[model samples]
Target: MSLVWGFLALLYVSTDGLEPVPVALLAAFFTIFGAGMNVRLERSLERKGEYRPSRKTLALAILAGAGFLAVLFTGVIPALSRPIIGSFYLGIAVAWATRLILLWRWEAKTKRRIYVEGTWVGSFYLVPPGPLQPAPA
Candidate 1:
C-alpha cells in the first residue's frame, strides 16, 4: 500500500537525491493501485448505505490523473528534471492518504455488517453464530 511505496521512495530518494521522474512515476503508480482498492471498498459500503466517496473526491482523483498526464507529456520532466512533477506526485500521495483516513472513519460509520467474497472464496456464513464447540486439542 501507500506505506510500502513511501518506504521504497524513501530508499530511492536516499540514493537518487529525489530524482523527480522516478519519484513521481513510482508514487503515481502506487496511487493508482491504492485507488482501485479504495473504490472497491467504497462500493461495498454503498450496498449497505453506509458510505460513498463524494463527487468532490472523484474530481480530486481526476484532477490528480490529469496533472500527472500533463507532466508526463510536457517534456519538462525529461528535459529539465523538474521538481514540478514531484508536486503532482505529492498531490496523488496526499489524496490517496486522505481517502484512506476516510475509510477508517467509515468503518465506525457502518450501521450493520456486510460481507465480500474474493476470487478464492467458495462459501461463507451470513448469519450469526449458532453454537460454540470446544477445540479438538
Candidate 2:
C-alpha cells in the first residue's frame, strides 16, 4: 500500500504534472491511507503477538513526508509535459508492482513480533510499547 501510494506520487511527479496544491492533497490522502492501513495491520499483528512499527518508524515517516513536500515544492523534479502521462502511469505501475513483489518476498523471509495493550472505556484506547522489552509478563 505504501509502495502503491508512492508510485502514484511518482507518477504525479512525472506526468501531466500536478500543481503544488493538488500534489499536496494527493500526498495527504496517500499518507492518511497508508497510516490507516498500517494501523489495521498492526492491530492484526497484535492479535498474534507479532509485528508493529516503532515510534522511530512513525517519526521517520513524518520526516519523510515533510521532505517529500519540500522537494516537490523546490522543483527538484522537473515539470512533466502532458504528452507522456500514459507512459508515466505505465512506469509507475511497473515500479509499484515490482516493489510489492519484492516486499512480499522479504516479509516472507523474516518473522516479526508485536505486542499491544489496550484499556477500554467508552472507547478503546491502544497503548503500544517501546521497541525493546524485557519479556512478556
Candidate 3:
C-alpha cells in the first residue's frame, strides 16, 4: 500500500516532465484495482460467516478519502502549494479512520450474532449446521 502511494507521489512530482493526465489515469486505475480487490476479499470472507468489513463501510472510507483530497485540491483547506504535496497523507489518514471504524462495527455485529446464536467458541470461528447422528450398536 505504501509502495503504491509512494509511486503515485513520484508520478505527481514527475508530471511536469511527462504527460500529467496519463499518469493520473494510471494512478487512478491502480487505486481502483486495489479497492476492488479489498471489496472482493471482504465479501468472500463474509460469505463464510467470518467477520469482515461491509461494502458500505468501505465505500464510506473511499468517499471520505476522496473528499479530503478534493478539499485540498480545491483550496478549500488552503494548504497553499502544499495541498498537492500533502493531500496523499491527509487522504490516507481519512481512509484509515474510515476502515478502522468499519472493522470495529463489523466486529461488534459479529459478537452480537455469536451471543444470539449461543455459540461456545465466541465470534472468531463460524460453524455450519449438520444433522445429528445416532450411536452405533
Q: Where does candidate 2 stray beyond 4 Å?
A: 1-4, 16-49, 76-137
Backbone clashes in model 3, listed as residue pairs:
none
Better of 1 and 3 by lDDT: 1
| Per-candidate TM-score against the hidden true structure | 0.36, 0.33, 0.31
Ranking by TM-score: 1, 2, 3
Candidate 1 Cα errors over 4 Å, as ranges: 7-40, 48-81, 111-137
Winning model by TM-score? 1
What Cα-based lDDT does every candidate model obtain? 0.51, 0.46, 0.47
- Each candidate's clash count: 0, 2, 0
In model 3, the worst 10-residue window by lDDT is 113-122
Q: Please provide, for model 2 over 1-137, each residue's C-alpha lDDT reduced to its tens digit, 9 standing for 90 to 100.
A: 44465566566555564455544554455445545554555465546435445667667766866775576657666655332222333333444355345435434443333323422101112234445633234
The digit string of per-residue lDDT tens for model 3 on 65-85 reads: 578558655766533344344
